[model samples]
Target: MALPKPGTPVRGSTTGRPIMALLDLLGRRWVLRILWELREETLTFRELRERCDAMSPTVLNQRLRELREADIVVLEEPYGYALSKQGRQLLEALMPLQRWSEQWQKKLAAKADQES
Candidate 1:
């Protein structure tokens, strides 16, 4: 599927809200892992593939293309691929979600313990 662009209809939505578009893109497999791998350092194509073990180069290529189209990732030749400014901001935006997931994990563990 094409990278969901703002103002364009995306999966599960007709209104084309930016949030929905974002979700559609991020919902794709390996997209988040790519972002996370590039969070701290720029990596070459091979390096990125190594970081995301088991991810086929074909899929990575496609995801990178989509991310670049979305302005989330950029090619910084000599060094390799890196997150664009907006990509960094997007990662920052996801921090809250990470915290929530951690909290949710703890809650689930507690519930499991209670049932034990």
Candidate 2:
């Protein structure tokens, strides 16, 4: 399905602001995980499913279709599946967030230890 355009209603935002629409799409279960798994190399459907801890094939296929439609992923002649240029750029933008998540994970662990 074509993604909802900006200014159209999205999952959480009636205004469908671009950012909100993006968040809505990215927030879907396994979406980010799929993107992360594809960061280093193209993987076939089976490989991706295995990497994703055997996520149901149906869900994986659905997410893949959506990503392809969004121009965030493409299937190469023999490369299986890889991120498109826009997808790579988006991953680059998310790098800082990934770094922050590592630190946040540490902080959470420390807090849990203190409580324990």
Candidate 3:
């Protein structure tokens, strides 16, 4: 499958706005998990698969291929798979969202506890 890119049609938006393209790619099953796993360091295919709860090899391979095509992941010599420069930047951009999500979760949990 062709990876989503700006200036071309993407799943959610015909115009393929940059953010839409990114979301289209990230929306695929296991895509975010793969990126998250690679956030810290490289991992061999086996190690990554294990960390992902032994996901089907076919899906993992497909996701990795897609990530590489998007320039978000790269395979280094003897180091397995790691995030590329752009990927790191992407993670940096997401840090704020992560913090927000944690805060949101806390609020939700507190509300639930109060209800209980």
Candidate 4:
């Protein structure tokens, strides 16, 4: 089924703010991972599945469908699946978040070491 657009109620969101909609979609299992995996190259369904450590085909297909609907990914001839321009832009936008996560990981590790 097609997902509701921004400004309409979506899962966990009654206000339907666009950011909430985006977060709801991204929060689904494997969604962010799928996008991250596609950052560099196009991959066939099987390749993507393998890269995702053999995620269930059913879930992968579902996530791909949702991404396509969101205009973040596309299926192409000969190339299988690749990120669309919008997807690339989104990934680029996420670079800062990626950097932040690396720092956050280090901080957590340090805290864990101190506690231990």
Candidate 5:
């Protein structure tokens, strides 16, 4: 299939297949969380799920597959999942987002306290 150029209409899937497909992949259960768990250290699948508060095994496996396919994660020598170099780069790009989330979470908690 010819890929649509930027600003051109995407021909498949109502919301435009490319963006929707990306979002769909990202939106899978525990996908981002799995990557987040690997931010600092690699972990076996079992360990990853434990860190993720016991995410479903099936879902975790699926996310791992997708992440590996996207080259954002790799199964290393010890056979544990670790963020790929590309994934580390992506994480660096999201450092600002972490700061924003910290601020946003505090604000949200303060708002909740005020409401209570």
Candidate 6:
């Protein structure tokens, strides 16, 4: 789908269509994890990799590029990726989803145990 203009109200989106684009970006492999890792503090490329359980450097680099292009991530003076203001806002917005995910995880685990 053609992306909505920046700052345009994302049609068909309560949060707006722009948010769908956001979700699409975050849904990519390791993208959400990268954001989660950046939540506490900014880290150098190597540091990000280490905290990411040593994800392949190639994959990490690619995600960073996509995030930067989307203005959800920025490379700081010291050469570490940090969330842009918009990115921080997006992360904060997802807090409720994070709680929901934890609950979902527990529920699935319980179901698996029962099945076993």
Please identify which of the two predictions, 1 or 6, would achieve the higher TM-score against the true structure: 1
Candidate 4 Cα deviation (angstroms), residue 58: 0.9
In TM-score terms, candidate 5 sits at 0.73
What TM-score, to 2 decimals, does candidate 1 have?
0.94
TM-score of each: 0.94, 0.91, 0.95, 0.91, 0.73, 0.75
Q: Which lDDT tens digits does candidate 3 get at residues 1-116?
A: 78899989999899989999999999899998888999998999999999999999999999999999999999997989999999999988988989999999999999999999
Model 6: lDDT of residue 4: 38
Error of 6 at 108 (Å): 4.2
Candidate 6: where is the Cα deviation over 4 Å? 1-16, 108-116
Candidate 4 per-residue lDDT, tens place, 1-116, comes to: 45646998878789899888888888888989999999999999999999999999999999999999999999998889999999999889989999999999999999999999
Query: Counting only residues 3 or more apart in sequence or on different chains, how many pairs clash (N, Cα, C under 3 Å) in candidate 4?
Result: 0
Error of 6 at 94 (Å): 0.8
lDDT of 6 by residue, 1-116 (tens): 23333344454455546556566666678989998899878899999999999999999998898888888889997869999998899899999999999999999999999999
For model 5, the local distance difference test gives 0.78
Worst 10 residues of 1 by lDDT: 1-10
Candidate 1 or 3, higher TM-score? 3
Candidate 2 clash figure, as a count = 0
Judged by TM-score, which candidate is best? Answer: 3
Which stretches of model 1 miss by more than 4 angstroms? Answer: none
Q: What lDDT score belongs to each candidate, Candidate 1 first?
A: 0.94, 0.92, 0.94, 0.91, 0.78, 0.82
Model 3, TM vs. native: 0.95
Give per-residue CA lDDT, model 1, range 5-72, as digits (tens): 87988997888899999999999999999999999999999999999995898999999999999999
